[model samples]
Target: MAVQGIVTAADRIRELDEINGGLADMLNHMGQAIKALGPNAQAGSDDLDARKEVFQEHSRAAYVCTQAFHARMKRQVYALEEAGIILAQAHIHSATSSAKHKQANNQPVQGQGGAPPVPPASEAEHITNGGLGNLDVGWLNSRGNKVGMEKEAELLQEAKILLEDELERRRGPAASAG
Candidate 1:
């Protein structure tokens, strides 16, 4: 059981790493797209030039905000990955300790005994109880965490809403032109 927990945590960490990589790639693409727009105005008239300036300012601001957001998200993802590592280590340590304790008494490694050794508090619990930093790995895996299902659902809903809003904004100009 403890081994299974460790495996599961390892798998989750891999998944999160993949997700973080994809997000970083997306941020890089966004930055490249913004840069490709060029800073100099290509408008022919004074009024158009002024409008282009305003548009450039807004685009720069948005790009900066997005970069900041991406940086923060990356940090959070790294922290979560670190937490998973810690949890997996703890599981392995616990299992090893249990085996050693049983061996000293000449007991079977996996058989009815005086009860199994207590495992360390889960990674989610460690974070929640303030043993570690303030991160919600429970949302990633609620196996042993005290997190409510609703919280995870709410997070997914929020992400969906943000994506939908971005899609709508992107389509607005095209729809108006048509």
Candidate 2:
């Protein structure tokens, strides 16, 4: 789904570029047309002058609007990145809980020959290791030291509760802010 979102964003950027290019071409042609009229006091020249002013205003407005659009697109990309991170964390928490639960129940994890199951590598690992390194999850411990294992299930549950609360609040009728 994230990949789809990224591809859509890329397509939209290409479209925006094409639109801006077309606008530039149109503005350039308009400028050339105005210059072809060449500073004459002939009739309809005043009308051309008025058209030139309107074109300039339109060009300015298009440029300003495109700049604002680019800013918004940047913010959207940042938001998507954040959402991906949060989802990844939640996934890790879920996987860790499943592994621990299975271990506690003395059940043979799937395809593990009765050994304890390991949590999957996290997004941070993929980013830092270039997709080829140890699969240890390095969550922070209570003293701020990095621990190469799963976080406590209680902490993960607490975070889940908080996120659920936030989601519920957002879905409330009186919700006016994120």
Candidate 3:
């Protein structure tokens, strides 16, 4: 959903760019006409008025597109927030389950020898220690809970790239100049 929202926002941004280009062309043509005809010239004034009306239409369209882009961005943000919440919940569930498993294993069962309970290693420790690569994710696959996580990661990466491209485009030549 976030990826789709980014795409929708990007499309709206492109529409705004095209509309702005048309508006700029109209302004340039109007300026050239006025300069060529002088302020008092009435020839083709009706055409100029029609062009002004078209420019206004383009401006209104651009405004609507801008609003749409803003809405899509908000939706993307909401989607991301929801995804974060879900991931956090999953993490907490995993931690709780791991703790329970460790506790159960540490208990002395009937007929078991009275040896000291060995401290069980935890997946959460690996996660907290920043060892995501070492973190056990097979449990997720077995439970069918994170089957689409890889695809989600890819979509998020694409969204990030799209956003970066849009930001760079908005920055324009000034970013390169600096």
Candidate 4:
């Protein structure tokens, strides 16, 4: 009876570990995908309107991807919590069995003989302590985002300068009186 419970809990723990690994892999891939976006977007005046449209579309797509990643990560966290619970139960079972084993040898059930160990905090506890947003860029207003944001602003400034230069280069002479 108790043995079966122990086995079930162990199995649950292993499954959760696997899920966590897969989730980490997905998060890594998403990071790489976001990085695949090119840099130095300095389109000429002729293409300014087109470049603006492209930037807007990229922002929208990034938003959707960010949301999807958040949801998947949340599910992974929940799975980790579930696994922690199963592991705690397994620890209890092991302790109880040890107590039974001790008693069979005419020893006291814990205290007078040996005490069962308490389960340590789950790794999830360490992770959840610092919620999200370390790397998430969904909330642009966050001061934590200033680092890369400053660089982005600089890039945009350069693009604007390039557009002005292109405009000047393409400008024609003003028309005179007929």
Question: Each prediction's Cα lDDT score?
Answer: 0.58, 0.55, 0.54, 0.54
> How many clashes in each candidate?
0, 0, 0, 0
Please state the error at residue 86 of candidate 4 in Å. 10
TM-score (C-alpha) between model 1 and the true structure? 0.26
User: RMSD, each candidate, Å?
Assistant: 23.4, 23.1, 25.7, 26.2
Residue 116, candidate 1: C-alpha displacement in angstroms: 41
Model 2, 1-178: lDDT tens per residue?
2474454656656766866676676566555555545554234466766656665665666566567657756565455455453222233334567566657878655537754454444544444333222333444235463342345666788899999999898789666554
Total colliding residue pairs, candidate 1: 0
Q: TM-scores of all models? A: 0.26, 0.25, 0.25, 0.27
Candidate 2 vs candidate 4, TM-score winner: 4
- Model 2 residue 61 lDDT score: 63
Best by TM-score: 4
Can you list the residue pairs that collide in candidate 3? none
Worst 10 residues of 1 by lDDT: 84-93
Whichever of 1 and 2 has more lDDT, that candidate is: 1
| Per-residue lDDT of model 3, residues 1-178, tens digit only | 2464354555556655765665566566555544544432445564666555555665556555566656656554454445442222223324445456656777443223753332344544433313323234665568784647888998999999999999889899887889
lDDT (Cα, tens digit) per residue for candidate 4, span 96-151: 76566656667565654345532234623533213341324455356576778899
Measured by lDDT, the strongest candidate is 1
Candidate structures ordered by lDDT, highest first: 1, 2, 4, 3
Q: Where is model 3 more than 4 Å wrong at Cα? A: 1-46, 85-178
